[model samples]
Every structure is written in structure tokens, then in C-alpha cells.
Target: MSALPYPPPPELGWYDEDATVMPQQTAETQPAANAQPVASAGTTTAANPPTTAEIAQTTAQPTTASQDDDDIDWEGTVLSTAFTASAPKQEYELYNEQTGQRIIVDTGVLLGRKPSQDLPQGVKAVKLDDPTRTISRNHAAISFDKDGLLWIEDYDSLNGTYIIRDNTETKVEHERMRLQAPCTIRIGDQFFTFEQR
Candidate 1:
């Protein structure tokens, strides 16, 4: 008795020579082994690669401009612009209530005297040259925080800093204070108004 079932299955052989399983090759099906395989219409094959003419023909197909425009994300562009515009700009105007002078605050902070090599960058130092000698070289500083709140700090000046609201005066010494617009900021004898446009 055989140990294997079903005559141990038919012996495997090369497919080309397996006539009982594979159909005989016809002239249409078989080409010379060295010959490149032919490509069908509108198809590409490794051996029969596309010609320049065929490539040009495919690329020459006309495309509508409107169809190209439809691919753009206009809504996203508009939303991004609106988000950028909605962000609070770091811009303020400082009006000298005493002299009717105005200065734009665009930098991070502003000092009373002209900037020197010893001072750090991003601090806009201005020369006030106060004849009263009440203002210090760096009397006070004005800046805006990330939340767009305006802040004023006294640099421990000799005379002192004051914020007057509704005809009342509040002293601000070494500490910082949140500045509200349309109010008076008295740095020594000189008074200024902080405003946002």
C-alpha cells in the first residue's frame, strides 16, 4: 500500500512544457523571446515605452482655467487673513499732556533718554532733556504684554511716578501698573497720556 494519497499528486514541471495543463501557444500569443512585448492602445509597457509624440499628445490636452481655480482653498485663505487681522497689534500712541507732543510706541519698551550702547536692543530710548530735571535718564517705561494690556513701570526715579484718574493721583514706585487709556501718567513734572488706536 502507498503511504501517500491520490498518487502523491502529479509531479511539478516547467509551465511552458506542461502541455496537459497549459494551452499550446499560438502565433498571436507567442513572440520571439528577444522581441519586446507590444503595448495595447492607450497603454504603457516596460518594453514598449511611450514615444515623445505620445507624451506630447497626452500633455497637449486642454484644461479649463476655472477647473484649475476650483482646486484653490479660498475659504482657508480668507480665514487665515481674518485670524491675522484680528490679533491685537503692538502699537500705541503716547501724548505728552504738558507739551502737546506725540510719540508712537512700536518697540517692546520705550525709555526717556536716547538709547546708549549699555542699553539692550528693542528698547526705544528718547531724549526728553527735561529742563525741570524732574525726569530721570530712564525715568519710566511703557510696554504691552501678550494679552495686549498696557503696562507702565517706574525705574526707581528720584522724583516718582504717578497715575492720575478722574482728578485723583496714585503713586507707582518700583512696581508696574496696568495703564488705562485717556488718563494722565505723571513721570515727575512731565505728564503724558497713553492711548491705543
Candidate 2:
């Protein structure tokens, strides 16, 4: 099997191949004759003044899809846990491999963030064996397992747990499920998605 908790790199977009051409420069666009070329570690000449395209390329924000195989963005670092009996506020703390930084997330207020969606009617996620449970009690303790596996245990709910893969859904009617990276889990009506960092 392929590596768990990781999505394959996106296919190259059309712009990639077309944008590799060398940009042009002209004397009219060059700096005034009186300006001194900044000196660096070595001798310099005006034969190759940087172009706007070059500067834009140097200073441009790197696209997430352009990342190397080993690089990861915030979306790739998603981690989550689900609950059945108790509904504690959901929380997430993720690392950005590209930036080497940490990010904190609170699920309760997460709706204010981007990528919002409305819950579907009559579709709810719940803990297994908890009849009194409502769609609200989905709580989980999320941490990366030693093997890099994600362990999501049902705290005990009525309707049980459901996991979604490739748009196909599977119900969890047991104590817990060992989640791999880049999987989606649903508790009651709420949905949570995670990916590798």
C-alpha cells in the first residue's frame, strides 16, 4: 500500500510548462546611467539586469501545489478526534512543514474560517451504543500514534460512527477505529477531514 495519511501530489497545471521561458529585457527599461550597480560577493556588470518577471518570480508567494514531495502545508497537517458520549469543544494544533511553525485551531469557532459547508438534513454522526446521544456529542481525543496512525475511538454514542473514503461511507460500530492520514470521519451530523503535513 502507499504511504498513509498523505495525498499524492497534484498533477501539473497548464501554466507550469508555459511559464518556463526566459523573459526579455531592453535598454529603455534599464536603470538610469548614473545609478551604481549594487556590488555583491563578486564583480558585477549591467549585461544582466534583473527583469520584472525575475523579481516577481523571486518574490512571489510559492503556490502550495508547487511544493516538493517532502514539503507540507497547513492543510496537509490536519489532525482530529471524535467523541460519542461527551461533546467537548473540538481543538486542533497543527504544524506547517513549509514554515516550520505551529497553528492552533478550535473547532467550535472553526465555522468562521474558510471552506464552510452546511450540515445535511437527516444525516448525523453519533457514537455507537449511546441511544440518548444527539448529533452534538461527537468528541474525540486526537494524537498521532507511534506508527503515525491516527486513533479515533468512539466515546460511546447512539447512532455509531461513520468514516468516508473517496466519497464512499463506512459505519463504525465498535470501540475505536485506527485512522490513517488523509481520511474523513463523521460524527452525528458534523464532518471532520484530516490530511498529512
Candidate 3:
């Protein structure tokens, strides 16, 4: 889990010493006790209330701002050891056999020589170190579906993409295939291993 960047503390003597500061702001923001609340369909209130039809009409109004559950800040008790506490999110990494480099996979990634422009947001585009020109501009994509599963698909590359499991090479020709950890992924000629931590 990434921690959001918070604003730095104010510098020394930054606050105005002469300016009047209010201790509370509730008085300005609070609604008047006698003010009647505007209602939908008609002038509703505590006394008259609203009919079932009126309630339905108000509830059917279109929502402009929809919030995703992941964007919401959640507070809870977390039991974590020293090692796990530092990295709160479940992480997956790709170990390149040729380059001997480990790259962290967040959401999903696109491994290619030069990444394509037509990529969805939150998906990383990686420039592979392919000296043989075996990898395509957008060779293969590690896709993340809504069901929280990882998948690999070939983007009609000249060579091909494959996933090896139990020494059996399964070609990802056109259709996407589910990718499990501790398996070798073959993008063109280079090989990479997918592992979870």
C-alpha cells in the first residue's frame, strides 16, 4: 500500500500572530434550527414528510460522482509482522531471466520494446531490453480483470507469447489466458518468471 503525500508542516513564524482565529466553525456551517428543509416533488418537511412516490422520485436522481471502494480511505486494525507491515499491499513481481532484474507488477503491465500509446490507465508500459528485436512494440499485456485475477495475452506479435507450466508450453496466440505465480512467461525469445509475494 502506498502512502499518500501529505502537506509539510508550516515553517517557523508562518502563521499571522495578529489575525483573529476562531476556535470552532460550527456556528457558520450549522443549519438554523427553524429552517425548513427543501423537499423533492413538493415542499416536504418534518411535519408533512414525503410520500413513497416522492421518495422514489428523489432517489432516482442521477448520481454525478461515483466513488470506487479502492479510492476510499479505510481505517481498521491490522496485524502485521515487521516485514509485512512495510508493504501492506499484495505484490507480484516478474523476474527477467535474461536481464536478471525484478520488476514489481501493480495492477498489470505491458512488456514490449516500445510501449503502445493505446493503453488503459493504471497499467504500466515497460520497455524491454530486447537486442534481437524479438519483442514487438506492444508484444504482450499482463491484464488485470475486475475479478482480481492476472492474465496474459499476445497482441498479435510476430514471434508469440507463451506460459510454461509443469514444463508444458501453452501458447497465448489470440485469446487471453490466466497467469499463475511461480511460472515462466515467454515473451518472444526472452523468458521471465512470475512470482507472488
Worst 10 residues of 2 by lDDT: 107-116
Give per-residue lDDT, candidate 1, residue 103: 78
**Residue 115: error of model 3 in Å?**
0.8
Model 2 Cα RMSD, 1 decimal: 22.2
Residue runs of model 3 more than 4 Å from their true location after superposition:
1-89
Question: How displaced is residue 48 in candidate 1, in Å?
Answer: 26
Q: Candidate 1's C-alpha lDDT?
A: 0.72
Please give, for residues 1-197, the per-residue lDDT of candidate 3 as tens digits: 99999999886445644234554549898779998777665567787978899889988976533223323433344545553433334578888877787778866788888987666777788888886779898899886665557888899999999999899999998689988898988888888888987
Our tally of clashes for model 1 stands at 0
Candidate 3 matches the true fold with a TM-score of: 0.53
Across 31-150, the per-residue lDDT of candidate 1 in tens digits comes to 888987677789899867899998999999877565466456553455544456433676777788667678787665645644233556756676654657788777778776656677
lDDT (0-100) at residue 147 of candidate 2? 37
Model 2 lDDT on a 0 to 1 scale: 0.48
RMSD to the hidden true structure, all candidates = 16.9, 22.2, 17.2
Q: Which residue runs does candidate 1 get wrong by more than 4 Å?
A: 1-87, 113-117
Candidate order by lDDT, decreasing, is: 3, 1, 2
Q: Write the per-residue lDDT of candidate 2 for residues 70-163, one digit (tens) a residue.
A: 3555557656543223343344443334333343333221111121234344222322222324333444334333333445555455544577
